[model samples]
Target: MTQMRFGQGTNRITGTVVMDRRTKCLVKRIQPGQIAVIDHPDLDEVAAEELVENRVRAVINAASSISGVYPARGAAYLIRSGIPVVDRAGADIFCRLQEGDRIWLDHDRVGKVGESQAVVRGERLSAQTVWEKIHQTQSHFNQTVVAFMENTLHYAVSEKRWFMRPLAVPGMYTQLKGKQVVVVVRGTGYKEDLAAIYHFIKAERPVLIGVDGGADALLQCGWKPDVIVGDMDSVSDEALCSGAELVVHAYPNGDAPGLERVEKLGLAAHILPGMGTSEDVALLLADQEGAERIIAVGTHSHIIDFLEKGRNGMASTLLTRIKVGGKLVDVSGIRHFYPPKTERRRKAPLWAAVFSAPMAVAALPGSFTIDDSWLRMVWLSLRLWYFP
Candidate 1:
């Protein structure tokens, strides 16, 4: 492994190097001030948000951070967060440096400290460059959209089996017959929507099915998922042990990577082979389980959402929606639709007191000595209520 020494008086950023070709896995081992070495090409905003939340000091990408195939906003997110990203850092670094090695990144050079030569030097991404590239890509956005639509249509036809036939869903311990099921995915505005329908969740007591990391999202909002399904990469071990009935999504070939992890942890998980994203499988699971109503929270329903994820084809998602179309309800802006139950219940008592105030005063004699100011406040409230 080659090392590089910076000249005195020059500011050198130093941290422990943690490398993972998979950005999601790297996030688990990254510390607040550590340097993340990732090989994610066209890094997406979701991965960037996770890296930022972990507070990594800097990022070194073995692949192009923004490949210009799409406007992946991850590099821009890191730049905006004041975290430096060195893109196209040669793949040699993976062989040159091991995890937990002390490294220094100075300008365009990166390697171990106190050595003369750098292991891998690469271009440092700037906010300006990333912004320019994004705009450049957007200039040809119509072409990308056209390609995406073409892919979607092609896949839709190829994966029509999901809609044509009954889905083979795995059995679960959680009962779903005649019940409302809320399938949660960690998509856009998921947290907000969850908060909005919190009252419905409490009152209706829907069966909660979380897709991978969505399980953690449920836990974060103080709700326990009745079932958790996905590839199991993004979810934490803590969530895996939360006693939710685990369902591992398998490929058509019956390969389930998540099932191994579950078994290693001494937990049993049912493997279901289906063609679609984990979220899609989750909705299908609810429908197949005879759920009376299937409510989806934070799912991808828009063209832009698929585009943002750099997905060319949404065949599985489209087919899944078609399969469960009658039962599925995509939730958005739920906060506007319903207020929290506590707020509504609290207002009921206040309104009752306001309406009964005059009767109470009438029942009491002049000797009761009601304050004039209190009467005026009551009159104002009644006027506002009746007039408004």
Candidate 2:
């Protein structure tokens, strides 16, 4: 670490800057000790987690990390992780600087090397300030919920027809009748959730449906998708060619945004024209196609999640859940339901163990009764002798 002469009581961070308007895309290229310049407002938790993982020197955001629209956890997460954040730095800073430009950021002042004046300025966010904002956001939760409900009701009246009016369920090359389906979405807590259900996936061999980039998540877990469904965005080319049946999501008007991408790869995809999120679409596909049960991984189901997604409402998710009914199961908190695997021991009754051994005398059936603890001790001694 380099120590520069600062005007006392301020730390100066010296590093090359990596700028991107999209934080999610920016995280893929950012490395440790380099500053990140992002334009994402109300940054989501997933983006924040990635930034914390990258060990960035500092974050200079063009937009407000917390807009107070809802209780966003991004700025707080980064701040709590001990990464300094400069919030609301004007967008013009991007025009003044280029990627890989070595710069110094001290408190709210940011500038190039040897520059007499600071090139751009912003408010350095503190844990206390953001937490106070978060508290206020929570206090006004009812207002946000009411607004979200009104928005949802408005859209629900228009979208209910699409969800309830019989969506055309296309024939899948992979049969779903009476079979279990696992719909994987690369949302928050997805990795931990996926790890929790690994045994179920291995044992049941349920059909895997990856929604967009979730296909990449499945591949990372060493499992290939049986059917990949989304608007063809966010999913990588490698996952597209992983032999999974492609199902492209199109708008209700039949405009397929991802069709050209699929065509370019010479891949034939089944068009599932529907109105809803890709996660909702995947759920409906599994249900309408006769999947016995649909296990959802990383699907957004919480109010906080909808807020982070910048959604005023989730009419699609709500309607889809109503239609799909109770067969949908989420993998969140599954670790509590299905605990981690541990070692097991095999043992029989002491009478059985003794009789099995040659030249071993067993007590008469009526003479003595062997207790569980005694049987366990005998088994442990024998196991130690053999296993050792």
Residue pairs clashing in model 2 are none
How accurate locally, in lDDT, is each candidate? Answer: 0.81, 0.82
lDDT winner: 2
* TM-score against native, each model: 0.80, 0.81
How do the residues 1-388 of candidate 1 rate in per-residue lDDT, one tens digit apiece? 1122222255368889999988878987798888999988888777788898888888999988777677778899888887888889978889999999999888778979777578889988788888998888778778877888899999899879655666566666789999999998877667778877765675578999999988987988889999999999888898899999999999877899889899999999999887878998889888887999999998987666686565787888888887788889999557666555566556665577656876867886576564676665666555433332
| Steric clashes per prediction | 0, 0
**Candidate 1 Cα errors over 4 Å, as ranges:** 1-11, 189-196, 302-310, 332-388
For model 1, the local distance difference test gives 0.81
Candidate 2 is scored at a TM of 0.81
How far is 191's C-alpha from truth in model 2 (Å)?
A: 1.4
On the 0 to 100 scale, the lDDT of residue 45 in model 2 is 80
